[model samples]
Target: MNLGRYIRRTAAHQPDAEAVVCGPVRLTYAELDDLSNRLATALRGLGLIRGDRVATLAANRAELVVTEVALYKAGLARAPINARLGATEVAHMLRESDARVLLTDAAHLETARVAAPGTAVKTVLGYDGPSELGPGYAETLDGTAAEPVEVDCAPDDAAVLHFTSGSTGKLKAAVQTYGNRLALLRKSVMSADTRIGPGCRQILAGPVTHASGMPLMGIFFAGGCAIVLPRWDAEEFLATVERERATHAFVVPTMVNTVLALPSARDHDLSSLRQLVYGAAPMSPQRIREAWELFGPVLSQGYGCGETTSGVLFLSTEDHRRAIEGEDEELLLSCGRPLAEAEVRIVDDAGAPVADGEIGEIVVRGPDVVPGYHNEPDLTAETFRDGWFHTGDLARRRSDGYVFIVDRKKDMIISGGFNIYAVEVESVLHQHPDVFEAAVVGVPDERWGEAVKAVVVPRDGAALDEAGLIEFCAERLARMKKPRSVDLVTALPHNPNGKIDRRAIRERYWAGAERRVH
Candidate 1:
């Protein structure tokens, strides 16, 4: 069934229930549904056909959410572009996706116009400004009739195309189906009644273009209230949580680190926060511990990629408690077991399962896993072999059934014939009292073929020299696993999704290389 049906159902069931909030502005389920239908009608008036691609370049806002639901209702594929992406990257995605209509707010009108010059986008609709299409672009559709349009979309038909970091190379759009999204919501509900709590308000700070924000659909599916933060600010986030009585929220590692570093962190009455989900990158155990101490056991972690539409492995509240009680460090480091319907395995080079504790390429098979990429048959063949999605991640399954991700299969550093996972070294560095965040990469070495380098961001008011940090790592890790060099920085660069920009880090060091070989 089409996802737009859910919006209609929710509106009928709870017409007056709070649906979405952007700062002070709010909309009920009935209002949101009607607005989306009117927007769909507007797109239809613009001569948009079924399966046409409509792209939105905006942050987390009520208007953006309205546009997405409208696209789905109008039978157009929704492609939400990352606003943090560079002009060249945005141009490439617009050209590659062959978007038929482009939508933007005042902030991104110039960028959107430049990115898709001479493209099939017949008109540009800007929110809340005088556009070429005139001033009616941002009107509320409250009184408009909700006329549902029928389109031929199977369960497996592509509903959204989410772009990956492209840190290894060019960005790849991971195709997500309606079936996959529904499966994710189903599994998430089974894992825990994520909707329970007084004042069930949720804050979304991550970019809506990513799967991190896509889970908000589940909140909507359950008829819960969502508060959207256009961009992340430590003070603003804390204030919103307290003022709105937000019970749930999720942010990436960097945002978590920033929030913890805020001087007034302890002063905020964040008691309303019941569940704090964090992922998209490996967070330091020390950082996690600090977060637990500050926020209580409400903090949890989820592990997945755009291919899975957000989370396949979820570290629940019980797991968080176990980790705090010192049950097992290995379990704490793991991304947790697969969801009920998801199957995860570690496989060898010959497509055979490896023994427990043996590292191999991680593979996952489930209804939630995407079947293939958009149009790249060769890459799809390489990624989805034998009906399983090869995650390109190296991991080992523990005796307790949890899986610990080592590193990207292509990111494993072989120095002096020793296999070194960058995460292991970075985790060790994170244990240092002065270190706030860390990323480790492999650089070319004449003697070892590849040498390990650690780039670190120190915590506020903490001083960490290279020697002290190296000594700290050497204490916990073996000589070969320790970083050969430690470079201290105020902060590491991050991609739009908030993961460390390792490619940007390596480019400076590997400029003359023919190719970047891990």
Candidate 2:
């Protein structure tokens, strides 16, 4: 089966429909289908065989979407590098994936040039224009003859080399297969909260090469328009939704915090928002309430990782209304029940199912779960055991089947003899009206072996001190869970996915310490 056939069918159905929009560039269904086919033909002409890898290192743009569809048509594995990565990380990916071709823009042409010297990258295609490193993107596609190119691929054929590094900072690629990707497309539309069809405009506001790109295939297959943000600015996001009449959006919690902080947030006409989904990190109950008020009953949440392909759990708009306007107040903390075709269970270390209200790891079994990592067999064996992919996340299932993520197994803070989840502490920190952002980490303590440290960023013009913030959390959380000390800073670092960089903040405190909790 060819994944690109879905796009071909959609194009045949609505040739003149808008498929993608970014900045000043807009491509109709005919244009997108034709360009991707031509680009696939061009890559094949360049001698890239099926299962060969093609890497792209660029920010959100119209060409990235084209490249994704092109790779699907060519039956080539996609290795998408985050644009925010430095030259060293980019070079590491080039070496690890051994990608034959690299696609980039003028902004990253120099970095690509610097990193492609001894790697397998034989050519680089520039999106903006021809550079010293490679030829122009538009000219290359224009030169190739547009044909209906679709390579038949097996179910287990590798489709995407999804690279991610959590707190450990070691990059690992999850080999997502063709069947897995098809499962992702199926699940995207099966859930009522994630469904998008014709006349549905979905805003992709983050880097499209990773988490933000998960919804693209479904949007294309369903004949929906994708409005890609050139860059992330809260005001620009609001304006784009109003201007494009966008009906759906998927954002990280950090992005939502920035939108809530905007003084004119309520003034914007966000009436077109049919579904506003947030994930990557848990949002505070207070922030959920604020977002519901701002976005007008469109807020929802999704929970998943690359290993699971995309989301396996979804908190729908009805769930949000039930929590915010109804009696299920604690439902605000749940990431929600299992989504479309996924089997989710909380299992102990021995892989035994845990009873309700018991904390354990979230193990998922589904067609969307990848087989294993590309080159790390040992790590793969450790993460994917038997038939279930271990999420390494600590969560508890309520009697009603709702799941609340306690924290990542690695992010749990061991203070004295107590197990304190950083997310639990951070949730209370977010309740303070003066706090804009907060990160909780465990630091070396001479007395307790390790102590909890809170790093907070106050809202604009809010005079919040460390004592006030610590006291606020103390009132809401357990005495042992309360931060031992608080640091009021201007901002907290974030990873490429818009999640708080607790690893970065914690590293500073444990840089040269003799004992470390993480």
Estimate TM-scores for all models. Answer: 0.96, 0.99
Give the per-residue lDDT of model 2 (tens digit) for 53-117.
Answer: 99999989999999999999999999999888888889999998989999998889889978998
Give the per-residue lDDT digits (tens) of candidate 1, residues 130-175: 5754333565344345676545567787778887877767887888
Over the full model, what C-alpha lDDT does candidate 2 score relative to the true structure? 0.91
Number of the predicted model whose TM-score against the real structure is largest: 2
Give the C-alpha miss distance for residue 77 in model 2, angstroms: 0.7
Residue 476 lDDT in candidate 2: 80
- Shift in Å, residue 431, candidate 1: 0.5
What number of clashing residue pairs does each candidate have, in the order they appear?
0, 0
Those runs of model 1 whose alpha carbons end farther than 4 Å from true positions after fitting are: 133-136, 139-145, 149-152, 193-199, 513-516
State model 1's lDDT: 0.80
Ten contiguous residues minimizing lDDT sum, candidate 2? 165-174
